[model samples]
Target: MLDINNALEDKLLGFIGAGNMAEAMIRGIIRNQVVQPDQIIASDISVERKEHLSSAFDIRIATDNHSLIDQSSVIFLAVKPQAVPAVLKDISANTGAEKLLISIAAGVPVKTLAAGLPKGPRIVRTMPNTPATVMEGAMAIASDSPARPEDLETVETLFRPIGRTVRIEEKLIDAVTGLSGSGPAYVFMILEALADGGVKMGLPRDVAETLAAQTLMGSAKLFLETRTNPGQLKCMVTSPGGTTISGIHELEKGGLRASLMNAVEAATIRSIELGKA
Candidate 1:
C-alpha cells in the first residue's frame, strides 16, 4: 500500500469527469488505500454517469463543477480535450492558487489549460494509457512552472499504485501519447495476430488467445525484472537452427520492426496536429 502524504490525506480529491480513466484512478486509489472513498468526489454532466460512479465507487457526486472545485483540493481535469476549455471556464471562478489541477486530457497543454482559467492555480499535465483501467498503465507527467515539487510528488503518489510514472518535459508529452497512450491498441493488435497464428495452426480459439496473452505478459515481466537489453533477450530465445530463430527470421523479413516504428511516428505526428487544432 502507498503511504499517501498527510497533505493529501486531509484533502478531498475531485474528478471533473466520471469517465473510464477517472474511474480507474478512483478504483486504484481506494483499492490501494491511498485515500478513503469518502474523501473523493466526482462531477459529470450526465446524471446517470454521476449516479453510476457514486454507486460503484462509494464516493460523493458533486452536482456541478463549481461545487466540486469549491469542495476539493486536488482536481483531476479528466474531461476530453475538446471539452477542456469550457470546463476550465466553468470552474475558473472557484479554482485558486491553493488548489492543484492535474489534467489527463491528451493533446491539451498546460499553457492552454492555464489560459482558460485564473493565473495562479497550479497545473500538471499527463498522458496515461487505457491500460490504467486494469492498473498496469504507463504514465508521463509534466507540470507548469507555477506547480511546486510537492504538487508533482502528490500526483506521482496518486498514480504510483496504478502503474509506472515518469516525469517528462511538456514538449515530449505528444510523443508519450503516441507511444504509450496509443500503445495498448498496437499491443492488442499484435496479441490478436499472434493468437490468429496459433488458431491457424489448429489450436482452439480460446486456448490460443490465452496462451498468446500469457506469453506477452510473461515476456514483459521478464524484460522489466531483468532490465536486460531486449536484443540480448531475443538472442537468448533464438538458438542456432531453432524454431525461434525461424520465427524471428520471418518477422524480420516481414519488416515488423519498421512497421512498429512507423506506427509510433505516425501517431506522434497526428498528436501534434491534434494539439494545434
Candidate 2:
C-alpha cells in the first residue's frame, strides 16, 4: 500500500484542470483533511477559474500546466477527454518515471495515457461519477503495467474520501463508466419520476421530492449497512397485498425493470463505442 498518510505528508498533489470533477475531489480531500491546502496545486487555462480555485480552497494555482507538473510528485489529469491529448503532450517532457499520474478523464484508456507520457511513468486510470460532487460517488481504477503497488494505493487514497472505490482490469472500466459514471443521471431521472408520481397522488412537490430523495438514500444505506442483495431488500419492503407490492406490479407492468436493464446495456455499449472513437 502507498501509505496514504505518509504520501500526503511528503508529496505535492497536482491537478491539470480545475473543472467540477477536479474541484470536487479537491474539496473532498481538504474537507477530509487527507491533504493540507498547501500540499495541493492546480492549473487551468482560464484565469478566472484559477483565481476562483485559489480563493475557494486557498491552494496554489498555476496559470500554466507545466508549472503544476514541475512542482508535484502526484498529478491528476482531470481534464475532459477532448482536452487530454494536448494537455498530455504539453506535460510529457516534465513528467518522468518517478512521478505518479492519476487520470479521471472518461473514455480515455490507460494505454493511451501511457503512450502520451514518458515510458515507465506510473499511470492510474479512474472513472468517477457526478455524485462525486456530493461525496457519494462510485469509482473504479486500473493501473498501467508500469504502475507500482504503492502508486495504485496512492490513487485509491486520493479517491477514498469521495466515495466507494474498486480496483478492476482496465478492460472493465468502460462498463464501470456505463454503470456508475452515467448511472447517477439514471437514478436522478427515477427520483424525478417517483416524485412526479407522489405529486400525482396529491402530495406537495417539496414534500414529495424530499420523501423520494430520502427513500432512495435510506434504501441505499440499508443495502450497504446490511450487505443484503437489493432483491431481498425489496422483498422485505413488499407485502403480499399492500401498497409496495401494488406499486411494484405497476412498475413491472410498465416494463420498468426491463427498460432499466436495457438502459444499462445500452450505456455500456455506448461507452465501448465512445472509447473506440
Candidate 3:
C-alpha cells in the first residue's frame, strides 16, 4: 500500500457502479486494511454483478443507487461517462449536501457533474490509469469549491491503497488524461517494439519479451529510486561511440520524442473535445 493510514474512519464507502475499477479498489482496500469489508456498499444494474461483488468481497450490496446513496457517506461515481447524467438525475434528490461524491468518469467536468445535481454538491474529480487494477496506477485528483480539505484527504486515502495519487487543478485534468490515463497503451506499444527488435537480433520470442519488459521495468525503477534526470541517466548509459548511442541515433532518426509529444497533445485535444460534447 502506498498509504497505510486508514482514512475512511467510520465513513461508509459506496460505489454507484461495481465494474472492474470499482472491484480493483475493493480488492486493494480490503487487502491493505484501509476499510473493513462491511464498511463498504456497492450497487450495479446487473444482478450478476451484484451477486459476484457480494460473494467475492463479502460486502453488503445496495438494491439500487438511491439506497446506496442513502447508506453511504462517501460515494464513488464509477459509472461509464455516458451514464453519468442518468445516474446523477436518478440520485440527485437522494444525495444531499452532507454527502461527498467522487467521480471517476473520464472527461466529465466538475461543472457538468454539478449541473446535474443540487446546488453546492461536494464533488471531487479524479483520473486514474488502467494500471490501478494491479495496484500500480498514477492518479490525479481535483475538487470543486464545495469539497472541503478533509474531503480531499479522504479521497486520497481511498485511492492511495490502489496506487499513487496527486492533487491537481481540474483544468489540468485533460493533460493528465492524455498522459497517465492513456500512458499504459503507449508503454505497451514501446515494449512490443522493443521485443520485436530483440527478435530481429535472433532471440527467442519469449526471451525477447522478458528481456524487453525487465529492461523497461528496471529503467523506471532506477529513475524513480535515484530521482536522477533521465537525460543524465541516458548519457551515463551511452559511452562515446557505444551500442546505446548507436540505438539512440536510430531512435532520433525515427522521431521518437516528437512522435510521443504529438501523441499526448492529440489525446489532450481529444479529451477537451469530449468534455465539450
Candidate 4:
C-alpha cells in the first residue's frame, strides 16, 4: 500500500480539464486541505471557466493543457474521452517518466493512455460517481503495468478523502462504471418515488422529501455500519404480516428487483460498448 501521508502532501497537482467532475475533485481536495490551494493547477479551453477555478480555489490556471502538464508532478486527465487523444499528443513529448498520470475519462483504457503518453509514465485509471460533489462518492481504480505500488497508493489516498475507494483489475472497470458510476441516478429515482408515495399519503412536500431522503440515508448507514447483506437487513426490518411486507409485495408485483438487475446489466454492457467505440 502507498503511504497515505506521502500522497496527501504532494506539492504540485494538475487537473487537465476543469469541468464539473474535475471541479468536484479540486473542491474536495481544497476542503480537506489535502494540499494547499496554491499547490494546485488547472486548465481548460474556456477562459471564463479557468477564471472561475482560479478564483474559487486560489490555484494557477493554464490557458491550455500543456502548460498545466508543465507545472505539475501529478496530472489528472479529466477531459472527455474524445478530447484525451489530442491532449495527450500535445503533452506526451514534455511529460517525463517520473510523473504520475491519473485519468478520470470513462472507457479510455490504460493501453490507450500508455500509447498516447511517453513510454513509462505511471498511469492510474479511476471511475468516480456524480456524488463526488458532496464528497460521498464510491471510486474504483486500476493501474497500468508501469505503475508502481507507491503510485497506486498515491491515487487511493487522493480519492479516500472524497469517499470510499476499492482497488480492482483494469478489466473490471466497466462493471464499476455500471454500478457506482450510474447507481446514483437509480437511487435518486427511488427517492423521488418514495416522496411521491408520501405525498399521496397526505404528507406535505417538504416533509415527504425529508422523510424519503432520511430513509434512504439510514438504510445505507445500516448496511455499511453493520456489514450485513441487504436481504438479511430487510428481513430484520420486515415483521410477519406487516406494512413493510405489504409494500415489498407491491414492489415485487411491479418487478422492481428484476428491473434493477436488468438496469445494471444494461449499463455494464453499454459501458463496454462505449469503450469499444
lDDT of 2 by residue, 1-277 (tens): 4566576456679999999888888888888877889888999988888888889999998768888887888888988888989898889897888778888887788777778886556888888886766778899988543588887788788888889999998888888887898898889999999999999999999999999999999999998999999999999989889889998889999999898888878888887776566
Per-residue lDDT of 1-277 in model 3, one digit per residue for the tens?
3232343445578999999878877888788777789998999998898899999999889999989888887889988787888899889997877788898877889888888887455889998877777777899998543588888888888778788898988989889989998888999999999999999999999999999999998998899899999999999999998899999999999999999999898888888887777
**Which parts of model 2 have CA positions greater than 4 angstroms off?**
1-5, 8-11, 143-145
Model 1: lDDT equals: 0.87
- Assess every candidate by TM-score: 0.94, 0.93, 0.90, 0.93
lDDT of 4 by residue, 6-37 (tens): 65355469899888888888888788777778
Q: Each prediction's Cα RMSD?
A: 1.8, 1.8, 2.6, 2.0
Query: For model 1, what is the error of residue 196's alpha carbon versus the real structure, in angstroms, after optimal superposition?
Result: 1.2
Measured by lDDT, the strongest candidate is 1
**What are the lDDT figures for the candidates, one per model?**
0.87, 0.84, 0.85, 0.84
For residues 60-165, could you state the per-residue lDDT of candidate 1 as single tens digits? 9999999999888889999888888889889888788888899898888787878887746888998887777677989999854359888888888888878999
Better of 1 and 2 by lDDT: 1
Worst 10-residue lDDT window for candidate 4 reads: 1-10
List of clashing residue pairs for candidate 2 = none
C-alpha positional error of residue 274 in candidate 2 after TM-score superposition, expressed in Å: 2.9
Please identify which of the two predictions, 2 or 3, would achieve the higher TM-score against the true structure: 2
Mind sharing the TM-score for model 4? 0.93
Q: Scored by Cα lDDT, where does model 2 land?
A: 0.84
